[model samples]
Target: MATPTQVPGWIAVDWGTSNLRVWALDDRANILAETQSPLGMNAIAGDEKLSFEGVLISLIDAWLPSDARGVPVVICGMAGARQGWLEAPYCDVPARPSDLAQGAVQPNVRDPRILVSILPGLCQRDDADVMRGEETQLVGFMDAHPGFAGWVCLPGTHSKWARVSNGEISGFRTYMSGEVFALLSQNSILRHSVKEGWDDGAFADAVRAAKVQPASFLHSLFTVRARALVARDGAAVAPGGAVLSGTVIGAEIADVLGLLQPGEEIALIGAGKLASLYQAALGVHGHKATPMDGTAITLAGLTQAYHTLKTASERI
Candidate 1:
């Protein structure tokens, strides 16, 4: 539990589809108290009885002090989607990363102690594609690496590759690579065949193979199933999983990685196994990636939005 004196400024939240994380932070963005909940956008959409603010308040209301008249709250992620707490709208691509708060909106709330500011996501109208939470992360990454120009990859359920140039998101692509991998591994026939963890040698081999035969993607995926069936021992299942992961990831890499012009480095923005996997996979293509912590970048992004909006509001 955080003492009342610890919360110096506003609250930060990353409210996604499946979960929401709230952080009580000082002006320095030093977290005072952090809390999480299963009340995500999906829960709000599925449960007709729950309002978005109702869900949000249920989780973090206790952290608010009675003395604060209206503490500022900055939020990111799916909470800004059309189906979220309140629609923050989307800023079209080829937009500056700092301009995310330009499309910000506030929720009609019952809580008198909180002033909520929801940051908008990014959209590609032609492709009919949208990203809800990652834009904040993008801003955070740019904040950390000022003047960084490169191909930045946010590896996740729906991985995103953004071309950041001159402090702007020049353009980007979203791949269903992670989401597809989950479906294939958990719900499909491969479920029984492969488990978590991997064989590094097998993973590297699979990455190389997939990178070569990008067209024979389905055939490559099947090799995992085949290997699972023929394996003499249980040891091969992990490698089978690795191969499956590599194949899918490689296809995504093949799809967009060539845009990496000469001397343009790769910024792999994420943490844990997913990011590590991306780093290793990029290595196979003779590219070195600067790995970053996704959580830190996400927090930095929300903080940036807060300051931007705060400064703007003060001007008015």
Candidate 2:
């Protein structure tokens, strides 16, 4: 075991639905250690009899340094929900990193010396939706682009398109495109309807179809099966078949793109492949796209939350 001298200055955590990410940082904000585990909300939700605090303690004990037992820790994401350890209430839209930090929920745990603060998620009355983890990504984006003013597209299970001005998240909308795609490709009849591989030409063709005839999105989706049946003997599309699948989704994105003002910049946040696909779709609609890794932004947001908490404490 390491001595007290080796203990980290602080701990940052991004606990979400399927994974737990922890980072041990020094006073200067450099990460000295990092760990991840499968103790996500899904695992905890599966065992409702166990209090969330108990599950968290077990997970933290397995990962945190013994010497760093009493270090301050800050957390972001679902860990702050009503179903989680403590209820960190939601902050309304046009929120800032400081707003979330100020709304941190401090849970009463066995380790009294360990300071733990959970950041709140973002909600907008206008949008009639809520975003828990994505707000952290927006915080990190603001950190990277200090004076940026434009729209950001965070494509994921629930894709979010946010409008940011100065450093605050002004407005946003969530689309179920990613989740819809997942369901159609994996669970719905469409699974067996398309070929296994992607073809750029076919994808571009579908994109074009969707863009021109967006009202046909639902109609065009089902036709993929008909196309495979007639053209490929009921087999999925050949090598370029995946592109056809993308076209249907790309068409939906094209419809949304019409709402944006001309010259508005768009930033895509997610894994590289998904971001690239969205970039391609956005390009087809004549919008410039920038991509950032979702994980990096989450970590950066957690770090920003920690700093915000530390500053608030100092002020108090």
> What TM-score do all the candidates reach, one by one?
0.91, 0.88
lDDT per residue (tens digit) for residues 1-316 in model 1: 3444554488889999999888888888888888888888999899999987887777666777666657888899888887778888789987775578878898777888789899999988776777888889899988888778888899999999988878888778899999999999999998876776668877788888887887999888888888767778755354668888889898888777667777666889888889989899889888888678888888999999988988899999
Relative to the true structure, how large is the alpha-carbon lDDT of every model?
0.84, 0.75
**How many residue pairs clash (N, CA or C atoms closer than 3 angstroms) in each of the candidate models, in the order given?**
0, 4
Model 1: lDDT to the true structure:
0.84
Assess candidate 2 and give its TM-score to the true structure. 0.88
Candidate 2 local distance difference test against the native: 0.75
Question: Which residue pairs of candidate 2 clash?
Answer: 194-236, 195-236, 195-237, 199-240
Q: How would you encode candidate 2's per-residue C-alpha lDDT over 188-248 as one tens digit per residue?
A: 7777865477776667677777878878877777777667667855654544346545665
Query: Which candidate leads the pack in TM-score?
Result: 1
